[model samples]
Target: MDPRFLGIPELTTEAPSVAVVVDVMRACTVAAWAFARGAERIVLTGTLDEALALKARHPDWAALKDGPPAPGFDLVNSPGQLRSADLGGRTVVQKTTAGTVGALAVRDASLVLCAGFVVAEATARVLRERAPDEVTYVVTGEDGRADEDLACAQYIAGRAAGGSPDPAGYLRRAAASRAAAELTQGVRRGSHPDDVALCLELDRFPFAMVAAEEDALLVLRRYDGNP
Candidate 1:
């Protein structure tokens, strides 16, 4: 069967066997870059305070939030910042505005994965390999009105359905989105200029980011296994 697309995460019920959350503007892109940089694992939190508290307790883990780095956090949730950090074997605590919240809201799904243009192809491959009876694509940005996330979700959903969708076309739509404009504004303010470009790097990672509950906390990690 074809994949189901969701807008408001809070109202989602009876989620399919697999749920793929997309936040192409930044959150999922950040995850892809962090894993690419060799971060051990990412602990996703809904609030900045929760992430900061976790960082305080761990002391060794890297803390990141949506905008600029907070007092207790190490960096912002930007791919450019993650690319420079030596995240090798370090745990990352992350709090974002939409991505992590949408992810954690998904219930009754056997597998929950995060996706952006960076890992879109890899995520589709994983879905095709697993071949779940049902799949749900959660566009976790601006109640699914965010063009970047919606475009990325459409691309992945098409690929998972055995179609060769033109990623360049999707990229164009994503670039014209409000989220992209926000990133551009962020760059002008010296908030990681490279992030705007980095988030659009299609198929940059070959691994998928999977989220699961561990020790009562939502944890994200790379899943590079065959079905």
Candidate 2:
């Protein structure tokens, strides 16, 4: 089946068998990096408060958020930060402005996955392997105006359809996006230039980030084709 790209707000308009939430500017990229750093799973939350509260309850899990780390949180939601941190297989509780909200809003998808350029090809592979009749790519930036997320979604969609999508073409569009510029504005809005560079790397990870329900909480874990 062909893949459908939808803005985060339009998720409720249709029920998708598989929902791939794209947040290329940072959130999903951070998730991908966290896994690479040995984090066990990420608990997706809609609000920073929820992530903080969960962290407080566990006291062992890391709390990651967009912008600077909150008082009790472990680190900022940047792939650069996760790159240096050793999670020791601990769970991460994550909250972001767009990615987490869009991911949590998906109500009826049988499978919900997180995607960014870093995990683009792996995500497409998951979609192809699952062979779901309905696949929706949720652009989780600026209600879909964010070019980085849109381009990544298009690339993944094309690949999931068994085509060899042009990564250079998609990279050009994503790098030129306003979202990409903002992340490189030198600590503006708690974003860093390193993050922009890191998030734009294509297929940096070889696994998809799958968000699954565990004990009534949405948890994201590395998925490498196994159900």
- Clash counts per candidate, in order, are 0, 0
Return the number of clashes found in candidate 2. Answer: 0
Model 2 lowest lDDT segment of ten: 184-193
Local accuracy by lDDT, each model: 0.84, 0.85
Give the TM-score of each candidate: 0.94, 0.95
Top candidate when judged by lDDT against the true structure: 2
Rate residue 187 of model 2 by lDDT.
Answer: 43
For 1-227, candidate 2 gives per-residue lDDT tens digits of 66778887777755677898999878899999889999999999988788888988999998988887559888788887678899878999989889988888774578998999999888888888877887888898988788899999999998888999779999999999888777776644656558888998888889988987889899899988746
Q: What ranges in model 2 sit over 4 Å off?
A: none
User: How close to the true structure is residue 133 of candidate 2, measured as C-alpha lDDT?
Assistant: 80
Residue 95 of candidate 2: its Cα lDDT? Answer: 90
